[model samples]
Target: MSVDPKTRPPRASAVRKAVQVAPTAVGAFYATSMETFRCMFKRPFHAREFVQQAWFIAGVSIMPALLMAIPFCMMFVYQINILLAEIGAVDLSGAGAGVAIIREIGPVVTVLVVAGAGSTAICADLGSRTIREEIDAMKVLGIDPIQRLVVPRVLASTLIGMFLNGLVSAVGLVGGYIATVYMQGASPGQYVTAISILTKLPDFLVSEVKAAVFGLLAGLVACHLGLNAKGGPKGVGDAVNQTVVFSFLLLFLANSVITTLALH
Candidate 1:
């Protein structure tokens, strides 16, 4: 005998709802993020929240940024020095390092650090607040969570992404200097000289723009996932995992598109 329509499980309906709602959710997230950015330009600036988030994103990301910078710097500089040595172009290794570090590696590594560390923290914090009903309380109190919480995180992450790009580039170049000058016995003067000769304004600006876009992507994903989290305690954990995966996926895609367009 067939079950009554009212008595039947809602599994199929739930699946349909999920499929339909997913796109709407994405669109809503994007719209809300843009609105948040716009709101930040208005009065009643949340200086306390903005400064706190900036500190959290930048301060907590520093160690990981350095860790990533050091290893990649050494590896890439070593490889470039070896190749330059083979061609007796060792003096230009600094220029090669500068180009690679500033144009690609610096922004990519810095954004990864922010996503893996800063985004995780934001997801967890917001997810916890969501599950604990603090977000609902905010709504009850007539508070706009997007204006108060979201804009700061997104703006802070973007600005921090830009800052970290510069920081990582500096560290990477320093490592390149040591590798080329100390490890390979290339002259310090030539290593420093070539960087100025090879890199210019456009490379620096492109890197900064890439980092800012990456940051905005990280913040948007983290905030969206965190706010929409469900299923209680386990859901928060899952949302954090999804945040990392989604952030990295979008970041790489954005990086590829930006690099292609900017370079062309």
Candidate 2:
């Protein structure tokens, strides 16, 4: 049976809503981003707030970063070692794992943890403040909420992202070393030497850049959604969810683009 025409959405109305949503979302993102940039460069900076938020983001992300770093590094190293052995390149295990981890896995895993943990925390805190009209109160008192809140959160997230990248890289290298030396029976000296020979300092720098970018974008998305959240508690929850999902999407795309440009 066909549905009643009257009960169906009008094409015009649906199109109108769709048209309105894209511009609204884009405008909101643009406004929040510009505000964040402005807040970042202005004087009378929120150093205390930045340090607190950075510490909080880093603290919350540690466990997840470790948990993510170890398993994936081990599994990748184990598999690559087997393949390399078939070609008589087993000694290259550390080089392969080290290069791969720093070039890609390090930043990706660290930012994944940061997005999952830190961004959610920022979103929730801001959402609660928004719902309670604390943000509005700040405005009424002549305090700029964006400067007081979003700027610090974004900086904190970026700094924490960079920190976590280092942590993940260290953990992944350690895990890969164990897997290569013991599980794969590779020579420890050869493994270390290969990594030293193959991976350069620039790889680490690029990875750090990716992590910082991911963190900054995640913070922007979270703060934007949280600041605009409506419908009370439910809206805040939705905004938090959106922050995680959108942050991940933006991050992976950014990773691909950054990797391509950096490598080529």
Candidate 3:
């Protein structure tokens, strides 16, 4: 028997609602993101505050992540060296691995760390203030919450990400080199030669640019979610979790697109 149109599911209704809500959510998110970006540049650049935030994000928060990543990098290099040696591709080891790590993994991993540590902290702080009406209180006092709160955090994240990318790249290279050359018994000169041949100035530029973009995205996502957070403590926690998850996903997607385009 043919199905009657009257008894059919309201697929059109669900589609229409989704289409309607999509634009509204997109508009709201974009508006908030742009406002935060503008707020980041409006105030006087506070060197001391920037430095403090940088120290926390780039130094303190980076430590645990680096500690975990270094050993993993070392292990990866050792395994690669063994495999390459078996396949007579040992000459491809040095700069090839280094360049790959810097141009791709470095920024990606740095952003992941930032999302987990820095983004979570930012979201929680802002969300708490929002929930407690401190953000509203600022408006009542003629202080722009975006300018005072969002700006500093955004600036801090961007600067910190740039710095952390450099730090992680160097540490990863060193760890990989030591592991491959000494631990894995790959000749030191071979490793150095490989690195020297593989790495280029263009790779460094691309990596730095990726780091900057990742930093901006992470900060924007965290601040946007936090500022828009409603409800109470549960909302704050949800915002923090969402910020990290979204940032991580975006960072990986960006890395893939950038890498594909850059290499192509």
Best by lDDT: 2
Clashing pairs in 1: none
**lDDT per residue (tens digit) for residues 114-228 in model 2:** 8899999999999999999999999999999999999999999998999899989999999999999888778999888889767899889999999999989999998999999
Error (Å) of candidate 2 at residue 205 is: 0.7
- Model 1 misplaced stretches (Cα beyond 4 Å): 1-25
Ranking, lDDT, top scorer first: 2, 1, 3
Question: Lowest lDDT 10-mer window, candidate 3?
Answer: 40-49
After superposing candidate 3, which stretches have Cα over 4 Å from the reference?
1-22, 45-48
* Per-residue C-alpha lDDT of model 1 across residues 1-264, encoded as one tens digit per residue: 987978767997798888999899779778877877788887777889989999988889999999999878978999999998899898898899999999999999977898999999998988999999998999999988888888788888999999999999999999888888888888999999999888998999999999999999999889888887888989999999999998999999999999999889
Residue 1 alpha-carbon offset, candidate 1, angstroms: 25
In candidate 2, position 56 carries an lDDT of 92
- Regarding lDDT, does 1 or 3 come out ahead? 1
**Which runs in model 2 stand beyond 4 Å of their true positions?**
1-6, 9-20
Please give the lDDT score at residue 174 for candidate 1: 92
Q: After superposition, how far is residue 149 of candidate 1 from its true place, in Å?
A: 0.6
For each candidate, give its TM-score against the true structure.
0.89, 0.94, 0.87
What C-alpha lDDT values do all the predictions have?
0.90, 0.91, 0.81
lDDT of 3 by residue, 69-177 (tens): 6886787777777788898898778866787678876887788788889888889888999999999999999988777777777778888888778877888888888
